[model samples]
Target chain A: MKRGIAGSLESNDALITVKESDKLEITIKSVVYDFFHKQIEKTIRDTLSELGIDKISVVCEDKGALDFTVRARLITAVKRMEASK
Target chain B: MRRSLLFIPGNNPAMLRNSDVFESDAVIYDLEDAVSVTEKDAARELVSGFLNCAGALPMEVIVRINGLDTEYFSADLEAVVSDKIDSVMLPKASAAYLAELDFLLTEQEKKKGLKKRINVVPIVELASSVLQIDEIVKCPRVNGVLLGAEDLSGDIEVMRTKKGNEILYPRMKLAYACAAYKIDAIDTPFTDVNDGAGLEEDCRFVANLGFNAKAAIHPNQVPVINSIFVPAQKSIEWALRVQEAARQASLKGLGVFSLDGKMVDKPVILRAENIIKKARKYNLI
Candidate 1:
C-alpha cells in the first residue's frame, strides 16, 4: 500500500505529497516557478539525499517558501510516509 | 537587557523569517509548546538550518526545547546546540534538570567546538519548580528565569486571570529569587493579543514588580512591552544625578552620602548605576 500525503499548504508554505513508487520521481509546482524553479528542485533533491530517501514519488506545491521551509515540509512528508509503513 | 522575548512557532517558517522585523530583544524559536508532536523533528531541523545559515540577525536567538524527561529532549538538543543560538530556554525547569542540562550543554559545546558557552534560561512552570526557584537560579549555566503562567496555572489548579492576581505570589517568589541571584526575571506573555490595553497594563504591573523583561507572543505587542520596560525620562534623569553624586562621594573617600535627603549607600549606588546603564543601553542618555 502507498503511504499518505502530508505537509502544509499555507501561504508562504508548501504542500508535499509522498507515495511509494517503483523508482524515485520529483515534481514541483511553485508560485515563483519562472524565477526559482531550478533552486527549488535542487533543494528538494538535496533534502531527499540527506535523508537517504528513494523509491518514492514526491510532489511539492510551493507558495514562495524559502529553501529551509521546502526542506522542512519534504522531511515531514517523508517521515509521515515512513510512519505509515 | 532583555526587554522583550518574543515566541515564534518553530514549525512556522514564515514567522521565523520575519521574526527580526519585530525587533524584539530576543526571539525564541519554540520547539516545545508551539510545535505539534509529529512535526517536532522537522521543526528542529528547520530551526537549526535557518540559524546556521542566517547571518547576524538584529535580535538574540533562543530555542525552547523539550524538557529533559521527554523522549524528544536529546534529539532537540542535538539539533539546536549550535553557535548560532544565544541560549536554550528549558521548559518545566527544576534544579535537577538544570544541573543535568548544564552538563549536557558543556558536552555539546565541546563536541561542536563552540567557542562561547550557550546560556540556559529555565522556565518555571510547575509548582515544584516555583518552590525550587532559588536553587534553579543558582545553577551555573543559568542566565535567567521565565515565568510560564499558563502551564503554572494548570499545575496549581487555578484559573488564569487577566489581572494576574492568582499568580502574584509565584511571580513575586520567582522575581525575588532572580534578583537575589542577580539574573534576569522575565514575565509570562499576555495571552490576550487583541486587548492591547490589557497587555500594556499587565506589562506595567510586571515591570513594577521587578521583572526585567516580558515575553511577547505577537509582533504588535513588542513595541508596547519594550516602551513600558525602558526606563522613563524622569527616572533616567534621577539615575544620572544619583550616579554623579555617588561618583563625587567616592572621590571624597565617603562610602555613604545623602542625595535629596535620602541616604545613598552601596545598594542605592548600585541601583542608580544599573539604571544609568539601562538608560545607556536604550539610548536614553
Candidate 2:
C-alpha cells in the first residue's frame, strides 16, 4: 500500500465547478493500476443509484481494495457525502 | 405454488422439524444424494415421523426418495406412500424410469388408501433425461421437472464457472418442456451464500424464463427467492389499473378494451387478474 492522495472531489452552488473542484482529497494507502479504474467507476455509479442520489462528484481513495471492498468503501463515502450535505 | 423449494437433509432432525419456519413454498426432505448409504434407513424413519407430525405447517412437503438403482428406494416409497406429503421427487430420472415410478406410485397410492394421487417431481440430471423431456413430462402423476446442476455438470464433464451454469441451454429446454406440460419447473440452488447479488440476478433470470420456483440449498437464500418471485409493486399497480379499466369496459358491453393505448383481450385480462390474485395471496394490495 502506498500513502498518497489518490483522488479528490468538491461540491458547491454550481454543478460543473463542484464536480470539477478538487477540495476533497483521498490518500490511498496502496498502489493500484488502471485495471481497477473502470470497476471503481461502476461501483461509484451503482452505489449512488442504491443511495438514491444523482449528480455528485465521487473521489475514491483506493488501497488496493478488491471489488467487495471497493463497493463497501464507495457506499461508506456516499453515506458520508449525504451526512455532510 | 412454491417459489422456493428448500432441500433439507432427511437425516437432520433439526432441519426436518424446523424447515417450515423458513417460509419456503415447499420443503424437500432429501433422502437421495444428500444422504450416505449408512444413513438411508435413519433418514427415512425421521422423514416418515416428521410427515405424521406436520399438521400445522403451511408449506408443501416433498420427499426426495433414493433412485431405483439403490436398495433404499423400495423402503423409501413404502414409508412415504402412507404419509400425506405433497409430492415424491424421483432423482436422476429418464422417461423409462419415470414410467416405472408412475406405475409403482399409482399402485402404492391405491394400496395405501390415499384418496389423492401422489405427485412425482423428476430431476432431469443426465443428458439422456434432457433428450427425452417431452415424453418424460407426459408421464402420469408427474408434477414438476427440476434441473440438477451438480450432476448435470459431472455428466457433461464441464468445469463449473463463477457464472455457475454453463449448461443454460439444456436447463432452459427442461423449463420449456415443463411449461408445455403446464407443470412447475424448478432451478437448482446457488451454492455460494455470500453472493447475494448473484443470487438475485439468477432468480430474476429464472423467473423471466418461466421457471415456477427455485430450489434453495440454505435457509438464508429463502427470503431473497420469495421477494424476487413476488410481483413488483409497479407491476401490481399497473395490473390493477388494467383490471379496473377492463371491468368498467365489460359493464359497458365491451368485450375488449384499450388501456394505456394498448388493446386488452382475454389473455391480457387474464394476466391482470392473475397478478391481482397473486397480490392478494401476498397481501400486497
Report interface Cα RMSD per prediction. Answer: 2.0, 24.2
Chain A only TM-scores, each candidate in turn: 0.90, 0.54
> Each candidate's TM vs. the true structure?
0.94, 0.73
What tens-digit string does per-residue lDDT give for candidate 1 at A1-85?
A: 6664545777778888888898989898988999998999899889888998767888899988898788877877887778887
Q: Give candidate 1 misplaced runs (Cα > 4 Å).
A: A4-6, A53-55, B250-254
- Cα error, residue B72 of model 2, in Å, equals 1.6
User: Ten consecutive residues with minimal summed lDDT in candidate 1 chain B?
Assistant: B45-54
Candidate 1 TM-score, true structure as reference: 0.94
Looking at model 2 chain B, report the run of 10 residues with the lowest lDDT sum: B38-47
Candidate that scores best on TM-score: 1
Clashes of each: 0, 4
Which residue pairs clash in candidate 1? none
Best by lDDT: 1
**Candidate 2 pairs with clashing backbones:** A1-A29, A1-A30, A2-A29, A2-A30
Q: Per-prediction DockQ scores?
A: 0.57, 0.01
